[model samples]
Target: MKDRVTTPLGAVTLLLLLVAVGLGLSSPLDVNQGSLVRLMFVHVPTAWVSYLAYGGTGLFGLLYLMTRKRRWDRLAMASGELGVLFTVATIVGGMLWAKPTWGTYWVWDARLTTTALSLVVYGGYLLIRAMIDDPERRARVSAVVGIVGTLYIPINYMAVEWWRGVHQTQTLKLLGKVRFDAAPVYGWVLLAATIAFTLLYLYLLRVRGILAARDEAREERELMNDLQGDVSGLTPHIAGQGAQRGGAQHG
Candidate 1:
């Protein structure tokens, strides 16, 4: 099948880069953080993407359990992989931005720690999927892990406010004098970045899904070939036995 997602993905990426560059160049620097505020363009989007990917993994996993469909399992696995990638990005970006602001690259800060732990947990989930040879068992086991892992997302997100942490409180809020209210430009750029990252996730998921389908098809073909060979071998053995029996009957 022709890939229709790639072209739109490229377009979205180009637009994302353009908007990010525009924000860096034209938007006003934070009076407090100065140039360091530029990291927001990269850091925030990575965090957003991680959240989206992991959440999707959980959602698809739930669907797999309900319907017992291999397609849903493939989707859950694909989203989980993307979640790991973006989670690492979020951590790295956080470390880079943290050094200047927090006076340290690594900290046991609640939000950071929980976020890291979440990555490990999800990584373990992926590892479990790899170790299992039975497809049904793998899908069932991984789906449970995927669903449970989603709990960490909300916990990490709220860790900053729930427990006093070195990490700053969220800048964007939905109600009551949003923090980004003053910086309309930053808000718009952030929105664009969120959309771009979401599109990127969808594109990657589609690619991974295609790979999974191909792998399953190859395995099926190999199994069929093996069965054909076994049948051919059995046919010659049966014919030899029949000829011996006929010779005995003629005697």
Candidate 2:
């Protein structure tokens, strides 16, 4: 398949850079936090995109099981992997912002704990796929796990909300009254990030689907070739049945 990342990734990156340039030329620098706050350009948006990725994965997983389509399975797999990556970016970005704000790198808060669990679960999912040798069995097992594992997302959100911590839930609600002081730039950054992440996820899914279909097709071809190449054992039982029928006809 043609490269998905080069086109989409390049476009999003160009857009991000152009937006940054515009912000630089026009907007005033944040007063209190200074440059560190700029990390929000990537940080906050990645958090929202990560959640979106997981939700999309869960939805696709359920759809795959219902339909038994390989494309859906591939999408769920790709989304799960991308979501895990975004999860890491979220944690790391949180730490970057948190260190200056919270005076610590690590915390035992609900948000961090639940996010950690979510990451581990998806990581285990990837591990499960890696360990399995049979492709069909792997798809079935992974699909079920992906579908069942979706429950964690809501729990994760609620955990962050319910538990008091230095951490704050991400605010992607851009259209409502501006939530943050840097709403204009921050919100635009998030929207761009969302579009970029979605494109990236989709590209990966399409590639994975094509690759999986090719692999399955290759396997089937090999099985057929092996059967055809086998001389004496081509149809041992079938040959026996034919012999019996011929004898009955003769008698």
Residue runs of model 2 more than 4 Å from their true location after superposition: 1-27, 173-185, 219-251
- For TM-score, the strongest prediction is 1
Q: In candidate 1, where is summed lDDT lowest over 10 consecutive residues? A: 173-182
Q: What is the lDDT of candidate 1?
A: 0.86
| TM-scores of the models, in the order given | 0.91, 0.74
Clashing pairs in 1: none
How does candidate 2 score on lDDT? 0.74
Whole-model lDDT per candidate: 0.86, 0.74
lDDT of 2 at 180: 50
